[model samples]
Target: MVDLRGIRHPLRPAGHGRLPAPPAVDRVRADGRRRQGLILGWRRRATVAVATVALLAVVGCGSTVSPTPGSSVTAPATSATASGAGPAPTCGPIPPVAPPSGLDQAGWWRDRTFYEVFVRSFADGDGDGIGDLKGLIGKLDYFNDNNVASQTDLGITALWLMPTFPSPSYHGYDVTDYRAVNPDYGSLDDLRELVKEAHRRGIAVILDLPLNHTSDEHPWFVGSKTGTGPYADWYRWSDAPQGNGWQPDGSRFYYAAFGADLPDLNLRNPDVTAEVTADAEFWLGTAGVDGFRLDAAKYLVEDGPTTENTPETHAWWRTFRSAVDAQVPRTLLLGEVWDLPKVSASYVPADLDLTFDFALDTGYVGAAQSGDAATLMRLMTNVTKLYPATSGFGAFLSNHDMNRVATQLDSDPGQLGVAADLLLTGPGVPFVYYGEEIGLTGAKPDERIRTPMRWDASSPAAGFSSGAPWESMSDDPPSLNVADESASNSSLLSRYRNLIHLRQLHPALSSGTWAPVASDSSSVVAALRVAPTETALVLTNVSTEPVSPTLSLESSPLCGRPAVFGAYGQTVTIGPELTAAGGFHDYRPVATLQPQSTVVILLGP
Candidate 1:
């Protein structure tokens, strides 16, 4: 171990005095082969855990840690204590880990709408007037009403609270203690009740798991610095503070790309692995959470923007999936994989399900906003070839992490009509963000993108809370809010509700495989979403004027059955109206697409 000037101080990890050895990080490189000779190829990353006094220093000293920027760290740092390591530690008879089984981690997450709530700024129950869990509890009904057209109508399937644990900052990413619940949010009892009540309502809950690093005040850092703590190996340390690790002590250290305050944990430490594994287990088994929406998944495998290309990252996910399944089965794991369809596909480890399709979200955003239907049609043509059919991707227009679709489409709501038509009619599970049905918009970086659900923008906290909202939004009547939309049969919200209900109306829309028929080649598209039992002819034209195209349906699994949609093109038989050559109308087109508009026709048995 590298020696440093001794600083006498007593410190220890916040929870256990000595952490259990962490699961091995070495396995990451093994599963995801690092290409040799590639610049910074992760395949060559050292597999050995670093042995250091820094973990000891951190746990003992009670010092604050601020990791340096752009730092790539190696986490497992403590030297393995020579044999006879005291009473062999107290944390129970945990079994050895095995490869993942294609089972669930936790239940209730599969078919739920995952609601993400920014805790510090959600709602305030007590006069203290801060949005807390209790406040959210008080307003559950509002959430329920928002899902009127969803599968259950009980609001979202799970509540993804930003971060409710104790930290110096408002957004609890810098965790001080894993077990401690922030009192401001509510007691641990409040969290338990939240889960209980949600479950009672057929809803599930998900929490932000920020295991990557911790706040500076963590006891492990302090105790390791001082002599009283024996758990320094709990966190990653460096041999020389100046190397890859960002160390203020000028002692070797380990760090992450996010920030130094959040020191990367040493997964190489078996104790670390056991602790996190147990934490996930406890949440799934004890806390009764539905599942997790993994954050920063792209950062784990190697240190870069493109994740799926590298195998190490996928291996890390596999480890998490396996560990979670062993504890609780039936859990849902949705990844935040922001990349092209090819790279994003890596995150779906066969059994590990659900990734957002960014190709359409970003590309469609660029095309539709310009009212270019031909471009949108061409992009979809490109999409059919980019991703795999069975991966089950999630198609969304907007989410808390990205720009609002309305804003992205430049507020020309007709674009939303076409976008929603494509969304509900596309080739994957569709997600509808809260308030998106009502048409929410915010300028870049203003966070209006994450505004509260506006049952009506006029209600108290827009019917979300009684206290002042943490963020302000742009005021627009007919263009914003749900109340007006619901009142007007033609409003965007009503249209969305209809679209959602429509998807359900035809099983073909939900379970079918997509096949391109024929397009006008420019501004109009007519394709088929066919299932074993149903065939849906989906059409959209995103332009300033309506243009019709005669779409034809001839082939599929039918091989010649005469079925049009609700099934495969090969399975379905062609009709007189839809021809292989010049489309319908006694051999003419149906109707030109509506200007900046769309239309979906259910053409089945």
Candidate 2:
């Protein structure tokens, strides 16, 4: 056997490479770096390490390591005629996503930590029972706070507010008027202030744009009842009961995807598309906002009654994407197409930049809860291959619609730690749910799944509201709140911040191309990637047992590199000539990766 401990490093870490960082960047890139070499690693493709990595790739990376959207089985490339070859979609040349502010919407996110704010549950400004934009404005510092954004020095780069449009419902997903702002959440000016404040802090803001369905009480529904106004076609009406789009009207009727209470807009109608596009444009064009978090993107233009994802629906998205790109070139377009991989990635070339990696979230959480670290390890390897090279993906543990991740895993903090590691360090953009940093938990209760944001752990009302408060912070207050967890590096908040900052410091983990490392058992997870500036190893022990894995650099770009990036658990020996032995033992930080933990260790420069 190749003995790692038996070998010796004849050269020091500094002796590895003389290549300096990119000559372009004025600021530091990633991997504990403030200023980094612009270009590093893999300058020459024809090398022993690269060749070996390709050979080991077959064993290290499994083609069967499927995704929730589609099993690892590669779907056959669809024919143009199959998707309906009408016209080679001609898109007008739109401005780039880079707005004059130099916000770097696309590149800016290459290394960013996303914070999800449920407005109604965040900070309360007016002492009213509900949370508002002003409340969020007050907590900008919390977001801008170094502890959360990792760049308190520079302020947050982006803020994703839960659905903020005018609505009668508590969560606000049931939009009443697209043009108006909810009075309960403050006025349009309030939203403008929040956006302005965030921008001044060098941050860009993204509001949740729910376009799937509208409240039954929405004015458009009332207008459609008479088949009048510029919105008659906005509501899907039915002359014949053909599919799910039919309902009883005065003489005839229409169908609403949701119950009769929610009338689905006919996105097939160009006017409807124009209006929705205009609404989004209003936020970016007039409000100076950065981008949008599109809700229920898959549900739009669904096939008949069932919520199926179809290529026609994809056509609708293409139209919408063309409009947005034209209006705000550098703006972010994040869709909530919480479903499959291929279907989701299809929206990319159409111009939809990113979407929720529900596939990874589901698979990651399942692995964590069951203590199957193997799945956690498979996550990065699978998605890194499936997702488009140019697209940005949002990684989150839990959000408003689903059960809190903690609730699913029996509230096990250790497992939660593993989940955080997967999202923050693994790949793509990392998003932290509103009260996630603080251990808040509560599922759908006619009450908001989004519990109010708690500023002080000990303060009564959890600093969310002076009024009796809309919901309870987890009953396990002492254990979950920020006060108890912030200082504890082991606490969720600290772990998230550490990973966030580390992600910012290391270029490899940030915007890096991933490669999985081959191990003896598929049970213990291990992988590698060539990050923006460095090479590193990512390891996670899904199970409780001490997993001693035989790791080889044959699958990663790390073999020949001198320096790498990552954090380890227990202890490991790095043998000269690149051999590792006695894989980390029980609970020993094989690279400081705590059992049921996520650890990224940098190896070469």
lDDT of each: 0.52, 0.58
* Cα-based TM-score, every candidate: 0.69, 0.77
Residue range 539-566, candidate 2, lDDT tens digits: 6667666555655443222222221111
lDDT (Cα, 0-100) at 80 in candidate 2: 13
Shift of residue 282 alpha carbon in model 1, Å: 1.5
Using TM-score as the measure, the top candidate is 2
lDDT tens per residue, model 1, 1-605? 11111111111111121223222122224567421111111011111111100111111111233223332323322222212222221222212221111122222232233456776555567735356788778656544433322322323334667777788766677888777678778887798888777665545567777766677677765555442356576665556443444555344455544676776665556677677667767777767776766665565533333323366657666777888877666776776678887666566645356667788776566656665556656666666555555225667787767777877776676777767767766776666765666677755563566555555555456644566665654454533665566666566765665555444333345545676766543665556664433344566665667665554334432111111111111111223222222122221123344465444433321
Best by lDDT: 2
Worst 10 residues of 2 by lDDT: 50-59
